[model samples]
Structures are given as structure tokens and as C-alpha cells.
Target: MRGTLVLISLALVVAGVVLLRSKRPAWYWMTFGALVALVRIAFTYNSVMEACGLTVPPSRLRLMLARMARREVPPDRPPRLLRTRVTRTGLVLRLGLRPGQDAFDVAASTDRLRHSFRAYGVTSRELRAGVVELRMTGYDVLKRVQMPAKTERDVMRVPVALRDDGSIQYRDYRQIPHALNLGATQSGKSVYQRNLVKELAPQRVALVGIDCKQAVELAPLARRFSALADNPDDAVLLLEALVGRMVSTFHVIRREQRISADIPDAEITADIWGLPDKLRPVPVVVVIDEVAELALWANTMEKKRRDRIITALVRLAQLGRAAGIYLEVCGQRFGSELGDGITMLRAQLTGRTSHRVNDEASAKMAFGDISPDAVLSVQAISAERPGTAIVGDYSGGWYRTRTPHTTLRQAVTTCNDTAYLTPDLPELAAFRPVLPPLTPAGPPSLIKPRPRPVTE
Candidate 1:
């Protein structure tokens, strides 16, 4: 009982200190705290008396005096550390940071904090300069830590964190196009893809989807997709065509290069930004679902396809930047064992999004080498929230994000509305899977004689 009471006392003290450490509240630590201290000391009195064998009866007032004897003195002023902010867009959030801290440190610490708090439906990133952006992950535990700080935004871009001027902070992700998404099944891996697709659907970018899962998962968003491939064969074909398109596009820019003093400064570059509206090249965002499946084949024919696929993927990762071809590859796990190509591939993808995973390895595969605490955070993601994820990109840190559930129906509807945006590319249409044609039924089987009359 004595030991238990002592532990409780220490805990209470620590809790109070931690709570008051940041905020500027003097009275809270003074008057009200003094009263609480008195109550706590009085309870400790019985133990003290029992141990010391004192004759004096311990009273609340006496305990109050004892409490003050050991209380820590208030600091002169609170430490003026950098301030932080949280902003929301739908279920996604953006985090902003203080000036002194580097983005990496803040990102790592934020990853630890997210782990401790189990910020499910929470994905945070640091923006250019000193901002952290977050996307709400799909999970329930996130509600516990971030509920009080939440501000809802229905738009695609969520300025989750704030600036010194209290304005909405944002970042241009196009600056880093290659992204790697890693997580185990049922851990919100799929949710990240959904979020990206939803964000890019309305953009002028062309969408290329490679779903090794027979397109069953991505088919709903077909209307927005310029090309969708199920098998590695089709994926390879699609990539080959995409690569050809990129080369041609680059050549056109090179051939058309006629920089002059009359040209606007922004138009001096060779990228699509430099072109006229009609001739502007559409950026292609390639999404790979279950990339491991693409690497699993072993036969000679399969090996050839895999080699070509890896080479093409690497080319996109290496040189696709200038060509406006970005790759967003999603997998259950990303490891070096997949091949030397894996290491090369991981380098190109600057953005990383990790949902909850089953093991430490999965987390490590997703995040290069996260703190043990952050790895623990991945395990905390529950299966109930299918759309919640934690995203870590090149800029800041791992963040909790719960991408609001936009059903397949919703995605389909969005795509169907903008189907006209589908580019005119005959190569893509040639390999598209042929849906079965509906056959007309002959006039009732029992009335077959009617057909004979027509023949006569």
C-alpha cells in the first residue's frame, strides 16, 4: 500500500508537470494546484505517520504546509519554442512547423507522436519551408488525439497547418512526382491510392492505372483512366506506349525550342508550362497496384516481361521527372530482395505513404528505418477503418490521414462526368479488354416460323 501510494503521488506530480509545462497559466500552478496538493499530502499523511510513529494527528492544513515544502517553484517564463498548427481537408490534414526545427527532425518526432497517439486517419507532411501537411487516415483511434484540434475542409488541398500570418499553408506536390506506398493488406494501403486518384481526377493530368489484381479494384475509376492494365503483359504494353509518348513529347519540345527575348520568362523552359494551350503536353500519373505481382513471374517469357517492366519503371523514375511522367507504386511490402532494381526504384519515389502494417518489417519497408515507437504506431491501426492511412512524403514526416470514404460509385460517377477528358490515343484503345457484346434474342423460340416467312 505504501509503495502504491508513493507511485500514485509521483505519477500525479509528473502528470501535473507535463500538463503545465507548455501553456502560460500561472494561477493553475499556484492557487488551484496548491489546493490539490493539500489533498494529496493529507492522504500521504497516514502513511507517513504509520512509518514514523508520530503522535501528532495529520490534518488537511498541516498536509497543505507539507505539500508546499516540496512543490517546484514556477519558472520565470514559459519556454518560447516554435509553434505548430494542424489543418484539415476532408479527412486529410496538413501540419506546419516552427522555424528552428529542421523538417526531418520534426517529421521523425511527429511520427513518434503519431505512434503514441495512434493518430489513425492521420497522415501529416511538412510543406516547403516550415509546414507539415496531414491527411486524415482511415481509423477510429485518431479521433481521440485530434478531435479537439480538427478543422474540416472539403477541398482536395488541405492547408492543415498554419503560417505565421495565420493563413492556410500549402505545398506543391508536383515538385516531387515519384511516390512509394507500402503497407500490409487491411492496413489502409488501398486507401492511399484512393486518395491520390481522387485528388488527381480533376487535374489536367492523364491517368494510367496498372492493377495486377485483374483491374477488379481500379475498374470503377475507369472513366478517368486513360489506360488500365490487368496483367504484366498489358502493363508492359501500356508502359511502352507511355514511354514512347514521353519521348515524342520531349522531342517536340526540343524541336520547337526557339527561345527569344520576346518570350515570357516562365515560357522559356522546355516543359509543358512553356507550351501553348492546344499544344500543351498532359502530365501522366502512373499508378501501380500490387507491384510485387509484376515481379513474381519466373518463366523465360515472364522473366522477359519483368525485365522490361523494371527497366521501364526505372526509366520513368530516373528520367520521367523532366518528361512529366510520375509513378505512384503501391505494394504490400517494398524490400531490397525484390532485386537491385528495387533499391534503384525506391530512390526515385520521394513521397512515401504508409498505412498500418502487420509487422516491424512491413513498417521498415514502408519507412526506411523509423523509430521503434513509430513502428509500433503502424501496428495500432485497426482493420475497421479501411480508408485511414499514415502518409510520409519527401518533405516532412509520417502523418495520420483518414481519406474520407469515396465509394467506387462516387469515383465512377466523377470519371463518367469527365470521360470526354480521355485523351485520343489509338495505341491505348487497341489493347483495351473487350467487353462481351450483348447478343439479340431471336423472336420467341416458340414463334420461330415468323423468321421463315421473312425468308420466303
Candidate 2:
């Protein structure tokens, strides 16, 4: 009877764990997963390192000393575990490298360690000269997106998504002035853009949109846009107006550039951010919903229009950073097949994000030159997971990221609430969209009044 009772208790515990792991992953990690991972790491650390060939042979001095004392040969030395920290998601291990071992050696063996430790994932980075930090996750962060409580937000930086390793992924316009976002149809690209817009709505910045698809994607949030263009002709006009504004901003910066021997070289400012608050113009973010729409041209007149549009885009990508203008170019595919300047425009976009692309080539367009591994990672994104994306930049570092499911209604409400924060740019006044007044909701009248008959 006692043995039967023990078996039943063990089965019940196992069932509870399985249920918690599938349903409440965070709770599982806190109550059971973290403890198991810690115990595994402690027990399997040495053997896992040896099995993965991460153990370095002991120094000649130590071996010789052991032999001189008529003792057994010294075993290979694995990295010393300097510290271990348990986080909400997983464990952080700080390791002190052996003399012959480097961070790469440890990084290469992370897969083995992860499997041995039974972790969901593992990533390693050099913390300093002789130390490496390994971040292991106990659960798949992208499976259910719950953003961390603390995120780094700044003047032009917004946390747009949660990274696979339980860190926030920020969209920093200052660091990367231009970015390319690529995703196929039904890939949740629009949802990502909505999240971006909602985050930017409350900031004191000007938003200009070029949605050549009849503004269907951007029109819902038109209240927050300083300038909007829906067609090729109107888009050209808006681009010209933006160029004019950029030129004016440059002139302002030139005037304010007080270059004197008394002033330090660092103090001589060139960008708008360095100017006095009163003299500084508001920053502008230009979002292109479909870059392909602007690049594709059929006839002679259309070719000229396309050339003009591409030229303006190239100029903005090349010089707009210094004038407080940034670009967020989104499309299904932006390749050489699009046009002549398509590759050039792409080269200038340092930040790249690829959603579930239709083909390997589409993924390559975003991450080919930066990270070949990232291309493979992008291709691995399943169509079933729409918002999951591989995000990378010029630094060649990439991460799996997923934006939480944000409804269009929520984005529109956020924009409407923060509409007053939109900056007024005089140059874009002519292109501003005029939206109809909203009707107020009210209770239905119980007694219907007699309608006016034959009034006309």
C-alpha cells in the first residue's frame, strides 16, 4: 500500500509539471524549471565540457610537477565557473577561461551544454578579456510573447519586440538612421508597423507616410501623420516637400554652427540634436509601406517618375541622417529585379528585419551580406508564426524577435489618444490629409420623432 501511494504521488507530480510547462511556462520556470536547470548545470558541467572537447590540456609545468611527485597525470582543465545567476527565464553563467581556451571555444560548445543541461536555448558572448557570459533560456520566449517589465526607451528609441533570449529588441533611429523590413503576404508585417506607429505617436516627432496602395495601410492612423501620400504623383510631391524641408534644416544647422577657436572641436555641432532646444526642428520619420510600388515603372513617363522617386530616396538615405530625418522602408521584396537603385537604397539601410519570407532569396536580400546564419534563421521562421522575425544590423549580430499581437483597433486608439503630439511641419502643410470628423456614440431614442415630410 505504501509503495502504491508513492507511485501515485510521483505520477501526479509529473503530470502537474507537464501541464505547467505547456500552459504557464513562466510559472513552471520559476517553480520547477529553474531548479532542475541549476541542478543539471552543477552535476554535468565537467563531463559536458570534456565531451564537447572544450577542456584544455593542463600546462606543462603542472604535468611535469605531477610526474616529478610520482603522481597521476593532471586532467584537462575546463573553464572555471566564476558565478551562476538564476533569472526569470533561465540561468546566466559567467566562466573564467582556461589559458588555451577562448570565448569562441565555449560558444561553439554551447549547443552541447544546452542539450546536456536540458535548456531550451543557449547563447554566449565574451564579457571581457578572460570571461564569457552564457545566457540559457528555460523556455521558448517567442512561443508566447510577454515583454519584460524593464525596457530601454530613449528620445528616438522604442522597444518594438521581445527577443528570443528574453531581452527587448529596440528600434533606435539614432543608431540606425534607415532600416529595411521585409515580409511576405499574411506575414504580420502590417501588425509590426502598427506597433511601431503606436510607439512613435506620443513622441514629439513628425511622421510622413508613403503608402502607394491607396493609403489603405496608413490611412486609419492618418490623424498622427504630418504628411501622407497615396499615389505615385502625390508621393513624388511629398518626397520633394521632404527634400525641401531637409535642405532647410541643413541651412539652420549651418547657421547655428558657431565654429570658433575658443570652442572645442566636440562642441562644434553639425546635427540638429546638437543645436539649442529652441532652434532645433522636430525630427521626421518617413515610413514607406511598399517600396516596390515606388520602384516599379512601366512606360516612359512612369520611368521618369520612378527615377525621380528613387533618386529622392537615395539622397534621403545618404544625407538625411544629419538633418534629423530617418527612413523605415517596408516591402515584400526589395531586390535588383525591382530596379537600378534598389540595391543602392538597400545598402544604405543598416538595420534589417526579415519575417517569414516566401523564398530563400527574399531572406538573403535582408541578411545575405550581413550574416549568412541569419539568412538560414529567417528561412526557418514558420508561416504559422506570423510575427516571428530575424532582426539584424550592420554589426552582424542577429536575434529571433516577435512582436506581440496588437490589434488594429488598439493601434488606432493609441494614435488617436496621442494625435496632439504630432509635430507641425510647414513644408508638409500642402500634403496633409484631411480626415472627416468622428461621430459620437449615444443611446438610441425610445420615442421616434416624426420625420420631416416634404421639407425639400
Candidate 3:
């Protein structure tokens, strides 16, 4: 009877795990997955390290002692595991490297450690001189993105997506002044832009949009845009106006440059952020929905216009950051094939996010210079996963990221709610979109229905 009861309990436990794995993966990881990973790491760490060549030869003292005792020599020593932290999404293992071992050695063997620990993913970073941190995700975070309850958010930094390692992927303009976002049709590139706009709506920064697709993508959030252009001609004017604004902001910073030998070098002002808050110009984020539209031209006159637009873009990208202006250039594909100045403009964009592209060359346009591994990762993105992307930057690091599914209506609502926060920049006042007046709700009927109607 006891044996039968034991079998029944084991079956029940297995069934529960199967159900949780499909229905509530986070819960399952917190309860069962983490426990199993911890146990596996404890049991197989030494063997895995030895197999991966991550183990170090025994010390001379140990060898001498073994010889003196007339016993077999001790095995090589693996890195000492200092601590193991269990997080909501994964485990963080901190290891102290043995002499002559370094973080790169562990990084090279991350795949072995991942398989040994039975974790979904593993990543390593040097914490200090002799310590390295291994971040292991307990499950496939991109499969069903659930953004954590709290994220690191600040001025000009917004967490727009979740990385496959269960960390938030922030769109930080302060760190990377410009970004190139690429994706084919139906690849959720628009959705990613919406999330960025929604996140920026409540901030004090100014939003400038140049959506040459008849403003189909950005017009819904017109209430929050300080300056918007829906055509190439208008976009050129808008870009010129932004250049003017950037110049004016530079003058302001110069005027406020109270540089003195008494002040520390760090305190000396250079950018808008260094100026006093009252004297600082509001930051501007230029979002271009389709860069190809501005680059494509046939006629000589049209070619001149395209050159003007590209020139303006190149100027902004080359020198806009210090003047409180940043660029978010999005397109289906961006390459030298577009025009003479396309590659020059791309060089200035340090951040890159590539969704499902039609070809490897398109992926290369985004990640080729950054990381070859990222290019491969982007190519592996399936058509079924619209929001999944490979995000990277000049830092030479990349991650698989997926933005949570945000509907257009939700983004529009957020923009409307935060419309009042839009800054009025006098430089581009002419380009500010004129939104229709809101229809007022009618007043309640003053006269009550006749009692005879109720009787009938």
C-alpha cells in the first residue's frame, strides 16, 4: 500500500510540473526549475569545469604533500564558487578565479556550464580582477516575455524590451546618442517604435517625427509630437529646423559655460545636461519612420533634395548629441546601396536593433560591424516571432530581445494621456501638427421623460 501511495505521489508531482511548464513557466522556475538547476550545479560543476579545461593544475605544496604522504596526486582545482543567488528569472553564480585563470576562460566554457547546470541560457561578465559572474536564465525568456515588476528607468533611459537573459533592454539615448532600428514588413518594428514613444510621452523631452509613409505610423500619436513631417519636403524643412535648434542650444551652452580653474574638470559644462536646469534646452528625439524614402530619388531635382536631406541627417548625427538632440532612424533596410551618404549616416548610429529581416545582408547592415554572432542570431529569428530582435551597440555586446506585445490603441491612449507634457519648442513651431479639437460630451438632458411614457 505504501509503495502504491509513493507511486501516486510521484505521478502527481510530474503532472504538476508538466502543467506549470506550459501554463506558468515563471512559477515553475521559481519552484522546481531553480531547485533542479542549483542541485545540478552543485553536483556537476567540478566535472564540467575539468572537461571544459577550466580547471587549474594543483599547487606545488599539494603535490609535495601528496608525494610525502605516498598517496595519489590531487586533481586540478576548479574556480571557487563564492555565492549562488536565486532570482525570479534565473541564478547568478559568482566565482573566484584561481591563479592564472580569468573571466575569458569561464566565458569560453559558458555553453558547457549551461548544459551542466541545466539552465536555459548562460552569460558571463567580469565582476572584478579575479571574480566573474555567471547569469543563468532558468527558462527561455523570449518565448513569452513578461517584463519584471520593476525596471531601471531614468531621464532619457527607458526599458523598452526584455532580453533573453531575463534582463531589461533599455533604450538609453544618453549612453548611445543615436540608434538604427531595422525590420522587414510585419516584423513589429512599428510596435517597438510605439513602445519607445509611449515611454517618452510623459518625459520632458521633445519628440520630432519624420514619417514619410503619409504619417500612417506616427499620426495616431500626433497629440504628443512637438514637430512632425509626413512628406519628404516637409521632412527636409523639419530637419533643417532641428539643425537650427541644435545650433541655438549650443549657443546657450556656450553662454552658460562658467568655466574657471577653481572648478573641477568634471564640473565644467559641455553638454545641455551640464547646464543649469533653468538654462538647459529640452532634449529632442528625432524619430524617422522610413529613412529609405529620404534617400531614394530619380530626377536631378529630386536628387538634390535627397542630398539636402541626407546632408542634414549626417550633420545631426555627427554633432547633435552634445546639443541635446538624438536620432532614432528606422527602416526596412539601410545600406550603402541606398545613396552616397547612407553609410556615413549609419556610421554615427551606435545602437542597433534588427528584427526578422528578409535576407542575411539586411541583418549584416545592422550587426555586421558590431558582432558577427549578433548577425547570426538575427538571421535565426523566426517569422512567427514578430517582436523578437537582436539588439546590440558599439559596446560589441548583443542580446536577443523581445518587446511585449503592445497594441496600437494602447500606445495611442498612453500618448493622449501624456499629451499635456509635450514641450513647445519655438524653433519648430511651424511643423507642429494641428490636431482636431476634441468633441465635448453633451450635457445631461435637463427635462425628465414624461411619466405618461412610463405608464404606456
Best by TM-score: 3
Query: Candidate 2 lDDT (Cα, whole model)?
Result: 0.89
TM-score of each: 0.62, 0.93, 0.94
Provide the lowest-lDDT 10-residue window in model 3: 447-456
Off by over 4 Å in 1: 1-75, 79-141, 144-173, 260-265, 369-376, 432-456
lDDT of 3 by residue, 1-456 (tens): 999999999999999899999888899999898888888888888998898899899999999999999999999999999999998889998999999998899999889877877788999999899999999998888888888888877889998999888889999899999999999999989999999998888788889999999999999999989999999999888999999988898898888777887877776788999887778888999999989999999899889899999999999999999998999999998999998989999999999999999999999999999899999999899999889999999989998899998899998888877777788999899999999865535876788744211100
Report the CA-based lDDT of candidate 1 relative to the real structure: 0.60
lDDT of each: 0.60, 0.89, 0.90
Query: Which pairs in model 2 have colliding backbones?
Result: none
In terms of TM-score, how similar is model 2 to the real structure?
Answer: 0.93
lDDT string for model 1 (166-251, tens) is 22333234566787777777765665576557555655667889998899878777777878898888888888887887788788
TM-score, structure 1 vs. true: 0.62
Worst 10 residues of 1 by lDDT: 447-456
* TM-score of candidate 3 on Cα atoms, chains taken together: 0.94
